[model samples]
Target: MHKRGQSFLGEVRDQIRSKEAKDFVSAELNHHLKAAKNKWIEKGMDETEAEEKAVVQMGSPITLGQKLNKLHRPKVDWLTVMLLVTTLGLGFLPILFMDADYYLQYNMDASSFSVQKVVFSLLGAVLAFCVMLVNYRRLESFGWLFYSIGVLILVLLQNSFDMINGVSILVIGPFTINSLSVMPFFLLAWASFFNHKKLKLWHLSLLFVCSFWLFVNTVNLPAIYIYTFMVFGLFLCSRFSRKIKWMITGGIMGSLLLLGFIVWPSLEMYQLVRLLAFVNPEQYAEGEGYMMLLLQDHISKAGWFGNALNSGTIPNVHTDFVFVGFTYYFGWLAACALFIVLALFIVRIIMIARNIHEPFGKLLLNGAVALYTVQLVSNVGMTFGLVPITTISLPFISYGLIPIVLNAFIVGVVLSVYRRKDLTSMRTFQPQQ
Candidate 1:
C-alpha cells in the first residue's frame, strides 16, 4: 500500500476511541481507497499516481475521522433506562408499604425488609452498570466456557442443596441463591453457541438434552420452560439453513413428547395434582389448587380502586405472589398501568434488537426477549389461574436479591449491545497491495 493511504488511515484511527470502531473504520477506508485506486488505474494512470489520486480524493483525514467518530460513538437508550427505573420504583413501593405484620412470620420486620430491598436494588444497579461498560461481543467467544460453568454450578447445587420451603437453593455464607439463577448464564451461553460459525444440529440437540437433564435433576419446571423457549428462539434467529432448522425443530418436539410420555406416569400424586390443578382449580381446592383459588379470589375481589386487602393469605406475597398482592392493594387500574410499563419496556428492547446489525448481539437480545416473555406470561397467567402455579417471580417486581441482580446483569448486557450497535460493520474487505 502507498504511504499516503496508510497515513490517512492512521489519522482516522487516532480519532476513534473504541478499538473495535477504529478497526472497522480503517477497514472501510482501506476498501474505499483500493476501489478508487483501481478506477484510476483502469483509466491508464500509473499505479503510484493512482494511489496518490485515491488518497487525495479521500479529503481531509481529520474531518472524516471526526465524522466517523461521532457516528460510531457509544449511545444510551434513555427510554429503556427510564422504564427500568419506573419498574424498580413500583416494585419497591409494595414492599415499602406492606403491613408490618406480614414479615413477622419470617422472623423479620417491614423496616428490615425495606432496608434489604434498597440495598439489593442499589447492588443490582451497580452490577448492571459494570456489565454495561463491557463490550458484549467479547463474550461471544466464551460460549462453551460459560455453558460449562453454568452446568458446574447446577451440578454443585444438586449435590449439596438446601431445601427452603420446597425450593432448591445453594447456601453460600449468608446468601442463598436459587438454582434457577443460573438460567441467564445458560441463555448467554446458548446465544453464543447459536452464533458460532460452525454450529450444527447435533450440537444443539446435545445442549438441549443436557439442559433437560439438569432441570430434571433440580426439578425446576419453570427453568425448563424458560430454557426450552430460549433454545427455540435462538435457533429460529440462528443463521442455519431452513432445512436444518426444521429438522431440529421436529426432533425437539418428538423428544419432548417422548419424555413427557415417559415422565407423566412416574410423577408423584402431589406432583401430578399440582400440574393439573390449573385446569380445574376447583377440584383440588383443598390441596394443590388452594393457592390458585386464593389468587383468583383476591384478583376478582380487587376492584378498579382495589380493596386494600392486606390479609396476607397469599403465600410468598412479596415474592412469587407479588402481583396478586399488589393487585389486592393497588387495584386493577394500577395493575394495568404496571402492565403497560412492562409492555413498553419489552417493546423498547425489541426495537433495540431490531436495529442491531451484529448477528450475535441480536441473538443475545432475542434470547433475553424470549426469557422475559415466558416469565411475564407464565407469572401473570398463573395469577389469573390461566396456567399452572409455579414459583416463577415477576421480573424486576419481585423482591429477591438473586433474581434482581441477575436481571440487572441481563439489562446491562442489552445496554452494552445497544451501545455498539452502530459501530460494527460485517462487510469484509480484501487487502490492497
Candidate 2:
C-alpha cells in the first residue's frame, strides 16, 4: 500500500477503536473499503493496482468521516435530557406566555409537560417492548384478521363505546388498541401484507371497497384519505398481479365519486365552507383561514431564536401548533433539526425496505414509510400554509400521549426491522430466493 493509504487506514482503524464511533458505522466504513479492495483483487490486479483502485473507490477516509459527522445515530442520553427537561420546566415562565392555554388546560403546575412526558414516554416504551417481542413477520400471517379487528374497533368507538373515564380500552386491558392511533398498522395489515397477491382482481376490489365503506364510520376521514393514497403507493411497490392494482384503484376512485354524490346533499354547510376555504384560503381569512394565518405569524416572529421569554404563544400551541414554541425557543436551528430528524426516519424505513428478504417485508416498510412521511409533511406544511389546515400532529414531538406512544411502537417496528439477523445484511447479500 502507498504511504498515504497506510496513514488513512491507520486513522480509520483508530476511529474504530475509539469510544466516539458506533460499531455499525465503523463496521460499514470498513466494509466499504474491503469491498473496494476485493473488487480490484478479483480483477487479478497487482498489489499497487488494487490499492490504488480501492483507495479511489472508497473515497478519502477523512472525507467519509466528515460526511458521517452530521449523521451520528441519535442516542437517548437521559442525563442530558433530564437536565433539558428541568430547564424547560423552569422556563415554563417563557413557555407559558406563548402557549398559556395549552399549559393551563393541562393544569400546568409542577407536573404539566414534564409529568405528562414521563407518562407518555413510559407508555411508549412498554408498547414498543411488546411489539419488539413479537415476530414482526408473523404479523403478516393474521393480516386480514387484524384488519377486521381494526374495523370492528373503529365501529364500536363511533357506534357504541364511550370514553367513560376519559380512556377507552381497545381490547379490554392487556392489548388496549386505540382506533385512531393503530390505524397506521391496521391499514398496513390490509393494503400491504394481506395474502391477496395471488388472488384475482375481483377479490382485491371487493375487499378494499368494503373496507373503505365499513371504516368510514370511524376512520378519521383525513387519515382514511391519506391511507388510501398510501395504499396506491404500496400497490405500485408490489410486483403483484397487475389486474389487482388496477381493479382496486378503479374501485376506490369510482366509490369516492359515488360517495361524493350521495353525501353532497346531506353534507353540512361547515364542511362545504372548509372545502371552499381550502380552495381559496385568503378569501376566508377571518373564517376558515384563521388557523393557517395565525400559525404563520407566530412562526415568522419566532425568527432565529424563538420569541424572547413568553411572547411566542400560538393558538392550539400544544396539540396542533406545537411547532410554535419550538421555533421561538430553539429558533430555525431547532425547526430545521426536527425536519432533518423526520426525513432521516422516513429514509431509513425506505432503506430498510430495500434490505428485507421477502416482498411482504418490503410492502410493510413501504406502507409505513408513506404513513410516516405523509403525516409529517401534512402537519408541518399545514402549519406553515404549504397545505390546507389538517389537524394531524407531528409524530414524535406533539403532546398527544396516545400518538406519541403509537409512534414509539413504530420506532420499535423499524428497530425490529433493523436488528433482524436472518435478513441479508451487508456481509451476505444473497439474492432473495
Candidate 3:
C-alpha cells in the first residue's frame, strides 16, 4: 500500500476511535479498502494508483471522522442532569410538609398551592429541555430583542398595578408576571452584546439609564441590590481593563447610594421597618422582624438532627424561608448536606464556564453563576438573620414557580453551552480542496 493511503486510513481510524465499536469499524474499513484495491488492480491499475483511488473514493478522512464523532458523542451532561433531578426532588419535601399542615397552621389552600407548584415545575422542566435543545449562540442575536421586551414588561408592570405589600405583581390574563424575577434574565442574555468591547461614553450612559430605569421601578430594595451586584459582576468579567472595572465599580456603588438616598424617604412604613429590622431584629421582633425572629427560634430548636417534619413552626416555610424551615424540620445535618450539594452544583457550573472557549457563552454562564451565587448567599444570610430579609428564593430548593423555571432555564443554557463547546468550530468541517 502507498504511504499516503496508509496515513489516510490511519487518520480515519484515530478519528472514529471514540466510537464504541471502533475495532469492528476499523476492521470493516480495512477489509473494504483491501477488496477495492484488489478490484482496481485487476482492472489494470498499478498498486499506488489503486490505493490513491480507494482513498479518494472514501472522501475526506477529517470530515468522515468528525461526523462519526458527533454521532457517537454523548452530549447530555449527566452530572448536571443528576444534580438538577436531585435538587428538585429535595425541594419538594418542603412543599409536602406545607401540604400536611396547611389546614392546621396557615389556613391557606394547601392542595391548590401544591397543584400550582407541580404544574409549574413540570412546565419549567419542559422549558429547560427546549432551551437545552436550542443553539446557545443564536440567543445572542436575540439579546437586544429580549432586553427590549423585558424593559417593556417592566414598564407595563409598573404602570398596570398598584403595589401589593410594597411590590407589584403584574397579572396579564391568567399568568402572574413578576417582571422583577424574569426581567434580569433578558438583560443577562443581552449582555453578550457588550462583552469585551470598548463602549463609547454614550453607550455607557445608555446602559446606566436602562439600569436606572429598571432600578426605579423595582419595589424591593434587596432585589435592586442583587441586580446592581449582578451588573457590576458582569462588568468585572467584561473585556474592560482593571482601571475601567474599578471606575465602573465605583460608579455603580455611587449610583446605588444615590438611588437609595432618593428612595429612602419614599419607602412605605412597612418597608422602612423591614430595613430597620435588619439593624435590630430584636427591637422589631413582634412586627416586621417576626419572620427573622421565628427563623432563629426554629434554628435553635433544630439542634443537630431536626425534630421530624413538624409544621406551623416557621411561617411562609414553603417560599422565602424554606431553608430555615427545612433545617428546622430536617436538622442541621440535612441543611449542611443541602448546602454542600448546592455548593458543588455551583462549582460544577463554574468549571463548565471556565472550560467553554466562547466569549458569549462564558459570559452567559458567568451571569448565571453570579445570579445563583448571590441569591444563594442572600437567601442563607436572610435565613440566619445576617442580611436583610428579602423575597429572594433559594435556587432549586425554594417553592416558587417563576424562580424555579428561570433557574432551570439557566441550567439548560449552561448545558447547551457545554454540549456544544467542542462543536462550535466544527459545525461545518471541510477539508481543503
Which candidate achieves the best TM-score against the true structure? 1
Where is the poorest 10-residue window by lDDT in model 1?
424-433
Model 3 Cα lDDT, one tens digit per residue, 376-413:
89988888888877888888878767778877887888
Model 2: per-residue Cα lDDT at residue 231: 66
Residue 305: error of model 2 in Å? 2.2
lDDT of each: 0.81, 0.61, 0.73
Best by lDDT: 1
Model 2 over residues 11-93: C-alpha lDDT tens digits? 55443432333444556555655666677788999767776777666555665555444344333324323422332232233
The deviation in Å at residue 298 for candidate 2 is 1.4
Candidates 1 and 2, the one with greater lDDT:
1
lDDT of 1 by residue, 144-223 (tens): 88899888877876775445565456788978766677877887799899888786778777887886788777767777
lDDT at residue 348 of model 1 (Cα atoms): 80
Off by over 4 Å in 3: 1-59, 62-74, 99-107, 196-201, 254-273, 309-311, 424-433
The weakest ten consecutive residues by lDDT in model 3 span 424-433
Give the local distance difference test score of model 2: 0.61
- lDDT-based ranking, best first? 1, 3, 2
Rank by TM-score, descending?
Answer: 1, 3, 2
Off by over 4 Å in 1: 1-3, 17-20, 34-50, 243-247, 258-262, 309-312, 426-433
